[model samples]
Target: MRRAAFGLFGLLGIVGLLPQAHAAGPSDYSILIISRERLEVATSCEIGVYINDQLAGRLFQEQSTSFNLPPGELDVRLRYLPGQVPGCQPGIENQRSTRLQLAAGQINKYRIAVDQNGLTLIRAGLGY
Candidate 1:
């Protein structure tokens, strides 16, 4: 009887730990931004993600390819090297800003345009 009780307690302990062990994985939300026009990808251009005006992360031109963010509301700013002319400057020179509300376990896509002033347009919707 003692051995059986010990084994039952061990099984319950393992079952309790299973949920915590399985909690680690990719973020619950994702976003993708693609350029609308074909331009030389700038090496210095960066995409900044802000949560409640706080700096969350920055993505370079290549890094802007995709994003995995927590489920919440975020203010996203895509800023290029300010004061530089497009195609003439050494880095990107544009800016685009938008807000997003992400739901848990949802993937969304936003088609963005980067011009002289920054992200000029954002087409956002659910993703497959």
Candidate 2:
């Protein structure tokens, strides 16, 4: 009877440890944070964030968004999206996609700003 009790306790202990063992697996994704809090972009239009050439999220002035993506090369594009405000129509401005290398368990930050050429994504510090 003592041997059976010991085996039962060992099985229970193993069951309790199962979840912890699974949680130790390597991380599979990275974090992407895009903010439009910069005043450099004076336009009030909503900006569309495209990931891998597909529209993923939209950002308005003073707004931000985040995504959990698999670690690898990502093609990010920003375009003006039409919104409630007038003059926020799409396809009027010329823009290009930016390629970013992301790693697992990493946090990448970017902010929308306007350069002499036009609207662009600027790499930003984690504090922002």
Candidate 3:
């Protein structure tokens, strides 16, 4: 009887740990950055995604322009296309910065407007 009770307790412990183990999968949050203007202003722009200042990934205009970052607070920055002439306007350059606090299993959407005035940044998240 004692051995049976111990085994039952062990089984219950294993079951309880299963959920936690599965939770270790990739973060459930996604980052979507879009330019508000229809024109391809950022012809060769590079977007640097950082989580708490640690470089997560760099995306170019031609490749996966959007990114999926781990669920957490992030300080994202968009660097101008190298060697490209800077726009005269304040927000015209590709360099834009924004901060976001993301929750687990959430989808975060950001709209960045780029034009003669530089870049305007906005963020919204769902599924906190």
What is the number of backbone collisions in each predicted candidate, taken in the order shown? 5, 0, 5
Query: Best TM-score goes to which candidate?
Result: 2
Assess each prediction's global lDDT (C-alpha) against the native.
0.56, 0.88, 0.54
Who is ahead in TM-score, 2 or 3? Answer: 2
Task: Write the residue-wise lDDT of candidate 3 on 28-123 in tens digits.
Answer: 765555433333444545544544556655555444345665667666665443434354222444543577776765556655545465554555
Off by over 4 Å in 3: 1-27, 30-37, 40-64, 83-96, 115-117, 124-128
Candidate 2 ranges with C-alpha deviation above 4 Å? 1-26
Candidate RMSDs in Å, in order, are 6.9, 4.5, 8.2
With a 3 Å backbone cut-off (N, CA, C), the pairs that clash in candidate 3 are 91-117, 91-118, 91-119, 92-117, 92-118
How far residue 24's Cα lies from its native spot in candidate 3, in Å, is 4.1
Give the candidate number with the greatest lDDT: 2
67-125, model 2: which lDDT tens digit per residue? 99999999998888888999777755766788999999899999988776666789999
**Residue 82, candidate 2: how far off, in angstroms?**
1.1
